[model samples]
Target: PGGAASNKTYVIYSDNAFPPYEFLDQSTNTYVGIDMDILAAVAKDQGFQYEVKNEGFDASMGAVQAGQADAMIAGMTITDARRETFDFSEPYFEDGQILVVKKDSDAKDLSDLKGKQIAVKTSTQGAAYAESKKDEYDLKLVYYEDSPTMYTALKNGTDDACFEDRMVIQYTIDSENLDLKTVGEVLNPGDYGFAVKKGTNPELIEMFNKGLANIKANGEYDKILEKYGYQS
Candidate 1:
């Protein structure tokens, strides 16, 4: 069943720093992105009123777990550990980890990054992946609170490289006219989904899935992706 008009408050938690996925438009001081657009469409189709809060990614996850937020749409990757903590809707997008470095840098692949300092967001899958191969690559990891900080560190030569979602990193590089290039290939290709508290709200999950399907079928999803320059 849909939510009652009088009881129509649902909050989504997200970290607004991830570009193309979630970010603030400086000109209008409004939050806009593929994630926000998709979620709004889903809520309208499912008959629920909702709002998004720009918080840290880990905090967003915690909010859902604590029932302070109904769900999270923060470009979170589906992982075994996360699944154990929350229920996820069907994947809304496919993403993968990639390395970003100075466009003229000699690094061509992960192997070339041996013994180099790389920046990654703390508590994120990118950090986890880098840590997993820390010993093998003899890598020194620099952790930041968010993507912007990581990018800044990379720009200032505080770090040799930064690892992040390919789509987001690409978007940033182009938008900012940063002289950065994505290295060799994507690691840990994964799906992104909305997350809700585990073992509750089956109806809400069903409604989200239905709405997602409708949006994709009607080409709204593609349009949103293109709006963000994420389309190939």
Candidate 2:
């Protein structure tokens, strides 16, 4: 078991809501997802014990910076802005931001959303992307703390559409039977990576990178992603 102490133990921080990446199984009272599985595999291959703890995304990053957590395995995008704050391992997955709107809505693309209300989670890559286009589209950006609340704002007619990762929005639409559909092509093709506090564990980061490369080379990576319905 991984925990906060001992040289053999590595603390991992992740939010419990990003499906296919990390989420709680209420029935089993345990965290399970592609992220968890990959971490477990990496730990086994690298001969280290790791435990994952649920924490908000930004908080997790902060924990790593503060030396409270050894690393973070959240579904964090590798943005240039983020690179200035922490070091990221080689990307383990690639994803992109997509638009989600109620079925039958008038909004078809960013152009169609001129003067429209849009919802996005604050501080996310999606939000940054939206913010960049806010002026061009004449959009009113509504920021939420998390994905669930942003979806809620759209469902309750508080916003015209929500922007987030395609996989996450797709999972919610299917699981909740939401009257929502993804629109247009994905806007930003981004890579997700494990984050470590700057200058703390080069050795551990090297080990994780090696493990990740092994998984991809050996086909375990694709198999795990396929199990979660991720095409890429």
Candidate 3:
């Protein structure tokens, strides 16, 4: 792997505020999290160098699609819709959507939210999931550009509740000491993958898959997850 192209530093984009996946480390003034650590470990194992841009998730997706960035690993779910535009590496993690509301909320399930507003992040699985249930639940959808703002909307009463990744919302609640809680069962259970524009950088996907397998076998992957309070 010690070749000329291996020395090239690729550009990797990720979300700026999705904690446990990717987020700014204020004390160090740098980005760090599960996705960051996994990318660092995988690049090292596969002998590649990269620079990560902590752009918000939607912007990161656009950057990769527009060829402005080489790849992304923003806890992006691997779905048929995204597959049409991006080539995803083998799944690195599993996740699911969850309904989140304020801790004092008496919402036991989606039925309790009838005619209420639900917040969703733009161009995300959470948004899609909420959209799918909108008419069935007589819900109104409110869009936010990022996770923090979406959660803020829920907390400030701009929206009654929101949909978010199960682990992501849980992590944010614990880390920020927020008064939020998830209700109902997980939905749209799926896996997350590293991605590049379709057919543009198959080599990058290859490297990621290879390094991922190696790390999973050798225990680095589990260590990274456990570092962020996850059990493999």
Per-model C-alpha RMSD? 2.0, 2.9, 1.3
Runs in model 1 with CA error above 4 Å?
Answer: 1-6
Give the Cα lDDT of each candidate: 0.86, 0.84, 0.93
TM-score of each: 0.92, 0.90, 0.96
Cα lDDT tens digits for candidate 3, 172-203: 99989988999989999999999999999888
lDDT pick, better of 2 and 3: 3
| Regions of candidate 3 where Cα sits further than 4 Å from its true position | 1-5
Winning model by TM-score: 3
Q: How many times do residue backbones clash in model 2? A: 0
1-232: candidate 1 lDDT, tens digit per residue: 2433335567889987898888999999988898999988888777877889989787898789999998889999999888888889999999999988988899987689899999989878899989998999999999898899898888888999888999898888888898788987899999999889998666667778988988888888888888877663
**For model 1, how many clashes?**
0
Q: Positional deviation of 134 in candidate 1, in angstroms?
A: 0.6
- Best model per lDDT: 3
